[model samples]
Target: MEVEADEEAALLSRPRARHIKKRALKNKALSVSFDEKDLKDFVGGFHKRKKKRRKEAELLVQEAQRRKRIEARKKRKLERESVYGGAVPATDSGSDECGEDDEQDEGSELVTSISGTATYDNGDMKVTVTTSEISREEDKFPSEKMQAAGTQINWRS
Candidate 1:
């Protein structure tokens, strides 16, 4: 009798499912839509889209390189301006460090030209080489210019 009463109490304590109201205004159906052509292209045109993106990225990189080259050129111009005391130096202008005048530099080219001729010998199968060099100022050498200029001509510069 106690077991039967316990079973009856347990059944009474269990909760039962309740039915939902069918006339709920907030619970409504959704109307979904999609473009079939766009969906198909998105799924199938992977390589085409990737190629276009790669080309755009390449153009961006090229533009960046061009900008970098321009900036570097500007920096070099600034450096040249600093070296030349805010003036753009001419090709033949004299330098202060060496103090070489263009007139003196033109005069100091002692060996103006050097030419050679090769004569082929048939009997002995030998070639005779004859070379001649022309000097502009053999008497007035660099020694005289060095004495007046007080510095050696830095041809390497």
Candidate 2:
């Protein structure tokens, strides 16, 4: 009798439960629509942001170029000092080691003289010359020793 009463009490205290179904709305039915002008405005804003980014990139590039020039000039100064063992003298005239002057004449003077001249009558003529010299001794390859050196050679096609 006590067990039956405990079972009845447990059944009375149990909470009731129910299943609920949620219906999903169609994407096309629920989607918000925008006009052409709205889309154009959004694109325009994106382009403006892109332009600002490009300007910032250009500024970065300019700064990098300036730094590179400064570094190159400093390196050149260091190299000059290292080569000269000290700072260059202020009175030292800047000139090339192979002192080439721009104003110096570089051409040979052409001399003309009235030499003898011959009159020619039109006639076809051809001349050919060939020469040969023979050597007393000729150098030959040391094939016997080269073969004795135990070198392997492979030829394939």
Candidate 3:
């Protein structure tokens, strides 16, 4: 029909929006570029790159924590200095002593000295050790105590 032809002509005559979109896409496509080395690295070194990034982030976090701790210690030292010259002597000095924290962690690095014997039997070293009854109790002496761990007895004394 002539009306349908007129409608088709009107539709075709209108400046198309798809042409603008296509022109924009063509401009962007012309500008886009990819480096071969970078593309290969990204495609092949996924795990290694990820691990390196993680390590770098971890080191950054550790450094931040260390700096924070050092600052806190310095602040505490300044406060102590302002308090009193006659204050109780600290276990350690305020200056960076081996860059360590002041808190006493006895578990990590404390050594102890002991005098004589660490254990005293008090003349009653009664050790009743039954290791699977290696031999029947009847076969062993009644007054004897088993010294399987090489516990020295005063036989020569």
Sort every candidate by TM-score, greatest first: 2, 3, 1
* Least well predicted 10-residue stretch by lDDT in candidate 1: 148-157
- Comparing 2 with 3 on TM-score, the higher-scoring candidate is 2
Ranking by lDDT: 1, 3, 2
Question: TM-score for every candidate vs. truth?
Answer: 0.34, 0.36, 0.35
Which of 1 and 3 is ahead in TM-score? 3
Candidate 2 local lDDT, 1-157, one digit each (tens)? 9999999999888866754445433333466887999899988999899999999999999999767655654554455555444656455454323334312312323233333433333355332222222122211345654573334232222
Error in Å for residue 78 of model 1: 0.1
Model 1 accuracy (lDDT, Cα): 0.59
TM-score of 1: 0.34
User: How many steric clashes between backbone atoms does each model show?
Assistant: 0, 0, 0
Question: Could you give candidate 3's per-residue lDDT for residues 51-80 as a string of tens digits?
Answer: 899999999999998888778667665554
* Best prediction by TM-score: 2
lDDT per residue as tens, model 1, 1-157: 9999999999888867765677764587777789999989988799789999999999999999767655655565566565554666567343423433323433332233456666666774655554554233433486775564444222221
Error of 1 at 143 (Å): 21
Report lDDT (Cα) of residue 113, candidate 2: 31
